[model samples]
Target: MSVRHDWYQSESKVVITVLLKNATEKNYAVKIGPKQIHMTADGYELTLSLLHPIVVERSSHKAFPSKVEITLAKETGERWQSLEQKPILVAPTIQTKNWDRLLNEEEKAEEKDAKGEEALNQLFKKIYSSSSPEVQKAMNKSFSESGGTVLSTNWSEVSKEKVTVKPPEGTEFREWEK
Candidate 1:
């Protein structure tokens, strides 16, 4: 469906164009203004209105046509009446179902991660005795160097030694020194 709007300053009127297509194989009757336009398969309806376009579909189960064209006549002193009927009450339940599935997957992933961390901690305690001072010191150093946690087994280059630069004293500066 497409809609186009144009303004005529001289006449102080706006033209609206609406296009609608019926892709069904059967004939359909569409109410346009005071007339009902019958459209066959792949047929279209064109209307002219001075007001903005307001399209209404009678059936919610069937999809509307692919394209429709409408041209709005300029409103003089007469008011245009709408032939559109209220739509049926419907809510988007499919989107809610998909969201629930996503939430379930995320919860399962979190549970798996928690179990993996517990297993890793148990293995670390069994391989290295927690009571040993040397082991504790090594663990502390590792944690400190790794920013308090072993996130991964990957290693990166890190600066370990401190660097210092000293300025030399000249004889010209010694003359002013008290």
Candidate 2:
């Protein structure tokens, strides 16, 4: 059986939505791990080797009449290229299929479908995930210290001085209440 699902990610969590009409809590089972997810519903089994590690203890899910939402807390605040890991190799010979290429193209299509804030966040994540350690550190420091008002990719500038909040032209920046 084939299972249909979709996934999206935030700065700290990855949310997977499985389309399973008529699904119930008692009829479905979801298992989440640091690097994988195994799910079975209505005799349909689906497994995914995650692109990155998650905090299993902090992850959770909920079932609805029309779908299931699984939320995985990321171990790191890095962006995921896809929900599943890329295949390393394919069957050899003339009959060999380019499964990896096909999968990559599909993933690209999914990424392209993202819109608005989600699309922007995904772009930032992709940049951060592929950047150097110094750049990542700069981004984290600047973004955090500036109350999410700034994001700097230049390590030389970010590392040399502290980042200060720069709110919007008409907005005032305030610190979070503890």
Best candidate, lDDT: 2
Report how far off residue 91 is in candidate 2 (Å). 5.8
lDDT digits (tens) for residues 1-178 of candidate 2: 7589999999999999988876784389999989999989777878989989999999998988888899999999999989889867976667767999999999888777765569798899999999999999999999988989999999899988889989999999877799
Where model 1 places Cα greater than 4 Å from the true spot, the runs are 1-76, 79-97, 130-132, 149-178
For each candidate, give its TM-score against the true structure. 0.34, 0.49
Root-mean-square deviation (CA) per prediction = 16.5, 28.8
Off by over 4 Å in 2: 90-178
Per-residue lDDT for 1-178 in model 1, tens only?
2233222321322222233344344353334443233333334433333233322332111324653333323334343443233446797676445888899999999999999999998887765663466555555455555444332221221223222222244412122346
lDDT of 1: 0.40
Taking all chains together, the TM-score of candidate 1 against the true structure is: 0.34
Model 2 lowest lDDT segment of ten:
108-117
